[model samples]
Target: MPDAKQMVECPVAAMLELIGGKWKPVILYFLGSGTRRFGEIAVRIPTISRKVLTQQLKELEHDKLIMRKQYKEIPPRVEYSLTDLGESLSPVLAEMSIWGKKNVLEKR
Candidate 1:
């Protein structure tokens, strides 16, 4: 974790420190759709390497943005879904999507 002094310097930076990355937002976007297994997510977001995906998922779990459920069976099964906190971010993402369509895509 970054020090308090760094967080105090820029709050938005601190927030991004948790979520900002090449793959984190993409992971969040998929999880927003519904619960998914790690393999499912990996296949959907093919650009993300397995190692980076694992790291991103771990970070999201640590931040309480996503919940991980593990099932015991002959082969272990695990699923991930957004927590309540993560669901709260959905509106923000939606709004960004809307804005992007209007400003970015429309411009193009």
Candidate 2:
């Protein structure tokens, strides 16, 4: 791990810097389902531009939160899956999902 100073001044701040983006959590959520290809993820997340999606994936890979696999094939094959570190986030995300369903959905 990087030094505390190198990390965004504080642990929490650094954490947010890593996962607190417009699309990262959502990407993590879908990846929680299982491995998926770029196009598959793109189809599921329709609103994100391809450029943004690529950028987010690269960042996640750099953070060691996700793994990208490339395979040789007729065309080309790539898949993304959450790493163990990323899987550790599952419980938190699940709780948040429950909360959203309860507080946000119940009001509607």
Candidate 3:
């Protein structure tokens, strides 16, 4: 657990600290569907730079929300999938998607 001093008292704010960001949520959303390779994730989110994606992935891994698996092969391979905790956010992501389609996409 993080030190109380390090975490904001507000639950939402603290939750945001783990998953909130321009890219983190997006990354999680993609991973929510299934496991993805580094390139696969990059392809889904074209606007994210490789460097930033790497950083965000590391943070999510550190937070225990995602799992990174490496396979021993001639050309090294890594894949990412959500942990149980990460999958727990699926409903939240689903709701957000529905809301976006209704309130944002449909409005336009």
Q: Best candidate, TM-score-wise?
A: 3
Q: What RMSD, rounded to one decimal, does every model reach?
A: 4.1, 4.4, 4.3
Candidate 1, residues 27-106: lDDT per residue as tens digits? Answer: 88789999999999999999889999999999999999999999988699999999999888788777767898899999
TM-score for each prediction?
Answer: 0.82, 0.85, 0.89
Tens digits of per-residue lDDT, candidate 2, 36-84, equal 9999999999999999999999999999999999999979999999999
Candidate 3 per-residue lDDT over residues 11-108, each given as its tens digit: 87778888988999899999999999999999999999999999999999999999999999969999999999999988888888899999999999
Off by over 4 Å in 3: 1-7
Estimate every model's Cα lDDT from 0 to 1: 0.89, 0.92, 0.93
Off by over 4 Å in 1: 1-11, 104-108
Q: Order candidates by lDDT, high to low.
A: 3, 2, 1
**Model with the higher lDDT, candidate 1 or 2:** 2
How far residue 55's Cα lies from its native spot in candidate 3, in Å, is 0.5
Worst 10 residues of 3 by lDDT: 1-10
Candidate order by TM-score, decreasing, is 3, 2, 1
